[model samples]
Target: MNPEIIGQYLPLYGEAAILTVELGFLGVLFSAVVGLFCAAVLYLRVPILRQIVWIYIELSRNTPLLIQLFFIYYGLPKVGIRTTPAVCGVAGLTFLGGSYMAEAFRSGLEAVPKIQEESALSLGMTKAQAIRLVILPQAFSVSVPALVANVIFLLKETSVFSAVSLMDLMFTAKNLIGLYYDTTEALFLLVVFYLIILLPVGVLGTVLEKRVRYAGFGS
Candidate 1:
């Protein structure tokens, strides 16, 4: 709590916060790409792909992320796969967020009226054309809020990277505490770091939700 110690520590904490922001940004993007594709498989009623998507979702959604990260860090090498801790952290966050977000997309897809599909069919639109032109726009509009929430969750989930020895904000905080031997100041600074990393995502989510509501969805 000493002003001098905090003054000395501020620069390091700032750098660590930047790293945490990068991790959250990358993790959310990875999850959205993977989750949207998988969710589309189920929504489109792709025969074998639907089954595979379900299996993937169930396996990932049911497992704890810490265990998943451990497996990625430890078990991957045993099975002849190797990736850096940062890579594994991204993969872990992607799988964790993708499973949950896919379900949200699936639900949103179901919310879009089937009449729209029939209308497109009567106009001789191909399946892909109908889905792309008529369906996904509405589906995504409906799902935007949920997607934002999932992104926020993904951001928080990146904390697991610290457990695997990644030098994210949290890992830096732990090191600072150990090096400085001041638990209260180190932890207070870390909490500030987390808030700086995470609060904007919350504000962004609210803005996105408002945008979605104004888009003629949930009317």
Candidate 2:
């Protein structure tokens, strides 16, 4: 509605968007590592570690990112464990996203027939070699859709980074509204920036999913 106002605040939103992307990217990257490790533990059915992974997955999935951020940013300080807001944002996102990604990867791993592993082992491949060479590729293909969804979900979850005092897009928008009382303009820019950030990811995910399906990964 207000082109001039929108233009004026564009730089602020841009800066916030950059921070959002940086933090989201880190969170998702670390979450994938965590998820893969946990999924591997579960898949291998490692003795005590399997139970621990399950507990972690349930706890992370059950809790809200907001609460996790609060605990990290506020509660941790009580125990003398201080962390910057950016760190808190990334940590919370990783904790939350890892669980979802673990499930995605676990489902993908399970979807692969047991015979594939057996065949790989029969061919004199060690267990690790069989998993790395034969199983992971196919499982990852099956996981593309879910992994894309989790990536998008984790990126959107960055919206709550403001709760940790990060000057992310949501924070910028709220700050603008508070300062200028430009509710419509602020919200409009918020939606526009969010769309700018998320739309391409959604499109890319769709494209990737289709390719994976065509390659005979998932239904």
Highest TM-score: which candidate?
A: 2
Model 2, span 64-178: residue lDDT tens:
9999999999999999999999889999999999999999999989988888899999999999999999889888888999999999899999999988789999999999999
What does the lDDT read for residue 134 in candidate 1?
Answer: 84
lDDT of each: 0.82, 0.92
TM-score per model over all chains? 0.92, 0.96
lDDT of 2: 0.92
Positional deviation of residue 147's Cα in model 2 after best superposition, in angstroms: 0.7
**Each model's number of backbone clashes?**
0, 0
Tens-place lDDT digits, model 1, residues 1-219: 787887787898888777767766787787888888998888878999899989999999999889999999999999999989878888888888888889878877888888888899899999889989988877877888888778777777776788889887778778988887877877888888788767887898888777666434343
Candidate 1: where is the Cα deviation over 4 Å?
214-219
